[model samples]
Target: MQFFAPLVALVYLVAGAESACTGPNARTTPPPGAIVVDATGAYRGSFKTVSEGVAKLSTATGDSTLFLMPGIYKEKVTVPPLKGKLIVQGYTCDTTSYSANQVTITRAMAQNDIPASITKNRNDYTTTLLLKSSNVKVYNLNVANTAGNVGQAIAMKIDGANYGIYACKLTGYQDTLYANQGPALFAKSYINGAVDFIFGCTRRLGLSHATLVDFQKWHKVFFCTRKCFAQMLKQMKHILVTSVTQT
Candidate 1:
């Protein structure tokens, strides 16, 4: 069974995904490009928590539709070695649509300190996504942690996973958008954060056909048409990101 199992979990991770075990009938078939969070064999409706849906699958890799019901989920989550063309989606209705909250894959430290996995990876200068596989995708979800009462934290953290983040909104206070590692693509997404939120934060990162915004007053928009500051101090190989437009 392990051989036939997905090499990774295509969690449609908004920068996260996890693997666990459950009943056979519980493997819900999420809609194409939708992330799942329910165990009804179909990606629809709400579950008690996000874990309820994730725990049902042995491995969450490959093209999947993971839909999450709108609610304030007070839980800490982690997508351990999750990979593939995954799409994490949120269940939204004009009536039940919520604006903000926190959903973390990292163990919170001080609301500002990245997260346990991030801290460990960064401190050790390791890979960002902590990916054990590839072709992973994420969208329409927030993945972060405010463990130490820091404040509104990151929305999506694509540490080191190959994927895409499309048509989503990420809200937080500090280090909001952590592309710590990304040989991936991010398009048409709303990322909110303060204090150099998305600067010198990731490597080998690619931002193509995407609309990026940094609300922080001090944060600069490095929307150059080339490889941005390739290193921590290289100063945007071409130009720097410093522009914004409201629609």
Candidate 2:
């Protein structure tokens, strides 16, 4: 009973609590100069690397922003439920100016498994963004996997509750975005996949105002599990799937 009380309390507190953070080198505050990550959210500090900032959030579960300084912060990250409310922002990343941001959150997940079975699951390995934490929000950032095409490499994989992913883009080749067993709502977000991509077999995924952009040098969207794709199409409308493409 005592343990139950603490777990219940944590869940309630997390649901109501709002944590916010920006990259390490985010903009400074004005007037009072209270440095903040976003408009209402406040900025915590400058993390030389994303791991440092993520560690801070893992320690502090409240609304806090970890402003990442403009640089190429390369590492893998996992967002546990204990740590919530993270806002990672950065400067423009392009080929021209080196000042651009190149934060690659890597995971050992492979890229080429026709069947894509439990044996080939990268959950066994470290990942960039492991959304085990519920009621979390990630904004204004780019998550990439530089592990060259070999097996089933995944970008953003979520298996939690009430996720808010906005104004951000996830780039990868195969199995890029995996939303497992979670009721997710993805808006104004861009997802690029190759085969059986965006594969959330069990989760009740609600994707509106989203872009399912695919760059399949061979085929745009292919379903390896034929029976599964047929099941998804049974409930979803062809027009609704096409509407996602418009975004």
Candidate 3:
């Protein structure tokens, strides 16, 4: 009962945060002075690509935000370790769920496609977004690796501390979302994959009100090694896997 109280409180808090982050009442537009990336150039001084906007940010820019317009951004994005907090916000109509995510960072990189000179490992070759910066929050975005079950394709690779993902969608075949090293809070999100989708040596991971989908028809799903599970239970202080629906 003692442990259950705090757990319940945490779940309620996550639910409240989710409600606040989405819906018609929520703040639809990006915060003022945010680096805007719009494909159509509808917003003034907006970059055409996500990479271009990220390049403009620096250590001097305190508490920066990247606001993405509604479009499919087909490019490999890496948010290199930064100084202050960085918030990447995606434009969405129904911000309450991942189904309405308008911004997609997608790529078609597979093990067979990557050159031998780059990396032999399938994980390194198939990453769409590599976020190494601490104190980063990504909201209402869809990150996907469209290799179509070819090999190990990663939608996003998260490494660092104090990361949070809210109302987002991560989709791939194998090894979809990699929490390499960090303590991350994933709330109100949907993750879809076939094999070993959410496998990593992450220090701590908190999942609340999330949907984990196995898209492999009649094939085995949820592949995590015993060593990794043991590590997660031993090394991590608080590893919450609550309200997760497998579909």
Candidate 4:
């Protein structure tokens, strides 16, 4: 059964290739009032890093948006608690899928990177993108933890509720996505990992038209929903493959 899981998932992916998210369409320019981030310094007055743009929103009172220009951001980003809704949009040519995503936020951090003395959840420390705010929506970005074959490297860790992750790609080797708490929705996204990548304790989670590929040998545990009381809605069109040839 485990050997056939990947094939089953691939069939789902092929069947749902035309499905699209209900979120906003892809845009070439930043939306009005959005904070622009251009790593190449091409956009005048734009922040050079995602963290810098997020930092600017530390004291924001109303809805905020961060528009990341096309580039690879080699830094970890943390979205702190915000007073209102937040949207992080990345440059993409196609809005329907993550295949044409032009922006990638990557880091190579793992659980071993943290100091031994820290007693807090080390999983939070290994994430490339950490969300600590509610009412957050992320779109069209490739978020990766390049800590290859390392123990417990997280691509994205959501500690807040009401998150909507759309049209993005999340890649890692272990524990790729840590949905610590959620009433969250992941739509039109691709999540790739090897072991227990989608583990979470979220109460209500939805995977709509998404594909999850675990490209390593089958482990005893996959999707570790620990004491979660979860309402996991794996839509009929969603894909969950146990293995794939890593390129």
Cα RMSD for candidates in order:
14.1, 16.0, 11.9, 11.3
Q: Which of the two candidates, 2 or 3, achieves a greater TM-score against the reference?
A: 3
Q: Can you write out model 3's per-residue Cα lDDT over 1-247, one digit (the tens) per residue?
A: 9979999999999998677667663535778889999988988999999999999876774899999998999999988899989999998767677787889999988777777776444575578999989999999999999897777788898988998999999988788888887788778898878777787857477677777777653233334566666655454332333333334
Arrange candidates, best lDDT first: 4, 3, 2, 1
**C-alpha positional error of residue 154 in candidate 1 after TM-score superposition, expressed in Å:** 3.5
Model 1 TM-score, 2 decimals? 0.53
Q: For candidate 4, write residues 46-119 as lDDT tens digits.
A: 99999999988846579999999999999989899998999998987577788989899999998788899987
Return the TM-score for candidate 4, rounded to 2 decimals: 0.83
By TM-score, the best candidate is 4
Best by lDDT: 4
Task: Note the residue pairs that clash in candidate 4.
Answer: none
Candidate 1 CA-lDDT value: 0.44
What is the TM-score of each predicted model, taking all chains together? 0.53, 0.59, 0.79, 0.83
Q: What is the alpha-carbon lDDT for the whole of candidate 3?
A: 0.80
**Residue 6, model 4: Cα distance from true site in angstroms:** 48
Clash numbers, per candidate: 34, 23, 0, 0
